[model samples]
Target: MKRPGIMIKDVFKRLTMKPVTSKYPAEKSPAEPGYRGKMEFYVDKCISCGMCAKDCPSFACVMEEIDGKKRPVFYLDKCMFCAQCEESCPKDAIKMTTEYELAHLAGNPQIVK
Candidate 1:
């Protein structure tokens, strides 16, 4: 009973203490070891390979044409965040990073051509 009250007061005081904030958007914080952030497309490394698209269980990924060039367009809305795309990439062009803050105005990943 007494410890709970003391603990409550300590927590309140700590909340107003020195601020521990990370510079988001400008500076990214350290993600966990297995963090899954937005998937990055290293087209240079990619050999126009369709392994990631074919292996995706959800079929959420799409390879589209971009100015006569074929590129991968991933639909985040349909994605399951299973990291299958990353694993399927032989060139390691795609990876899952720990970036939980993936907010977009469109609500869809318009990476396709």
Candidate 2:
């Protein structure tokens, strides 16, 4: 059994405040410097070498045989958002970009070859 006057005062003050949330989509946000978004592979620069796969800390990177050639297959789901893949990359084939926003309602992130 609490006082009704106290409850009414708290509710009235909440309605007077300005909205604190940002309008997403309508108001886009930029990624911070060095932020890692989606990972893109440079096929031409890639020598089909297994160096990146062997050195990946999270094991998110893998190589698959395709028409007698080994190509990289990366699963973003397992990726730890660390820049290890980019640093261990000798050929500079794997580069990191600032892509922080990657939310989806339906499917997870996919990189098509």
Candidate 3:
């Protein structure tokens, strides 16, 4: 139980304070450097080494046979985006981009093939 005078003083202090939240949808903020958001896979750069799939902590990356060669398939829904796959790639095929708006409807798989 707080005193009425103390409560009133606290209320006045809070009312004068500036808002701590950002205008998200109305004003987009750029992602900082080294902020891992989405992944971009380059087929031409990939050497079919399967190291990216093997190093993924969330098991989001799967090695699939495509055009007679093994390629890494990214399941964005299952991915934690820790950038382990990007670090493990020797050919620099997998790179992380800062585009974070990845919302999609349920049951639709966000697969990067």
Candidate 4:
């Protein structure tokens, strides 16, 4: 029903236009506000209540004995980044940072001491 030349015209128009996607690896994108990417643990504010470990869905948070005191160890390999630990911390010991580059070759967990 449409003219055959219309399809050709549309294709040519698209070909002359600039690309919309950015060069990712060569160029870093700015993170937006309130973006939850990574987790940061504050040992000074922690109370050893173990609430962060208890509410963690992925079991990424675990209380370990550190220098005769119980401390939280975070395993980023298994973490879902759901911010459950941040929400459950009554002492504001846990916080989320805008750091998403977590690629690693080592088979060890990222223990936050």
Candidate 5:
């Protein structure tokens, strides 16, 4: 192991570098490729296969029977933002969007068809 002076030098070097923090809300940050932020569902394209709910690792996805068709209900509070549901959808109905601003006052469930 190196001396403690080496660690101090590393810290000083980082301090001299430009800050990497983003000004969120005031300025939007670009998401990296394949970054999973939010989930969106295309209702008409969905076949009600229930694959998305079954494949969700966080148990955030649920298939509900609404009206005459089965719809997907996503609990964002319980989601890990893994985008597993998007990959499991056979009909290409589910998608992971770049929308990461999911803060809500009432915290309601997202009903996607």
Candidate 6:
């Protein structure tokens, strides 16, 4: 246990330094190349192969019959954003976007069609 005076130098140094954190929500920072964020599903490009649902480790991608065709219903709440669905899509229907602001009120699952 050192004296209280010992920490004074460190305190002063830190106070003089600029804040490392950015002002988020006001000043948005660009995501790096290949940075996976949100999942975007292209309905037209999808072949209803169910590969994305099969590859998803979190079970976020669930296939349902829509308009007599099997389509993926994404539950963003359960998604880990691993991008496995995007990789498994043979038709290139699923893509990962740079939009990371996915927060919502409780009971809102943030489901994607």
Best by TM-score: 4
Error of 3 at 110 (Å): 1.1
RMSD of each: 4.6, 5.3, 3.1, 2.3, 3.2, 3.3
Cα lDDT of all candidates, in order?
0.76, 0.76, 0.91, 0.87, 0.82, 0.90
lDDT tens per residue, model 1, 16-48: 898788677698777778777667777778777
lDDT score at residue 48, model 2, on the 0-100 scale? 82
lDDT of predicted model 2 = 0.76
lDDT of 6 by residue, 1-113 (tens): 75668888889999999998999869998888778888888899988989989999999999999999899999999999999998888899998998778899998779889
Better of 1 and 4 by TM-score: 4
Report clash pairs, candidate 3: none
- Model 3, runs deviating above 4 Å: 1-18
Give lDDT tens digits, candidate 5, residues 13-55.
8999998887886988878877788888788898889998899
lDDT of 3 by residue, 63-112 (tens): 99999989999999999999999999999998899988889999998888
Q: Give the per-residue lDDT digits (tens) of candidate 2, residues 1-113.
A: 86567777767888897777878779987778767877778887878868878988888888988677797878777777777877877899887877766566657565524
Off by over 4 Å in 6: 1-17
Worst 10 residues of 1 by lDDT: 104-113
Residue 53 C-alpha lDDT in model 4: 88
Error of 5 at 20 (Å): 3.0
- Ranking under lDDT, best-scoring first? 3, 6, 4, 5, 2, 1
TM-score for each candidate, following the candidate numbering: 0.63, 0.69, 0.80, 0.82, 0.74, 0.80
Residue 68, candidate 1: C-alpha displacement in angstroms: 1.8
The pairs that clash in candidate 2 are none
Better of 2 and 6 by lDDT: 6
lDDT of 4 by residue, 1-113 (tens): 86567688779988999987889879997677788888888888989999988999999889998998898899888899999999988999999999888787786656566
lDDT at position 66, candidate 6: 93
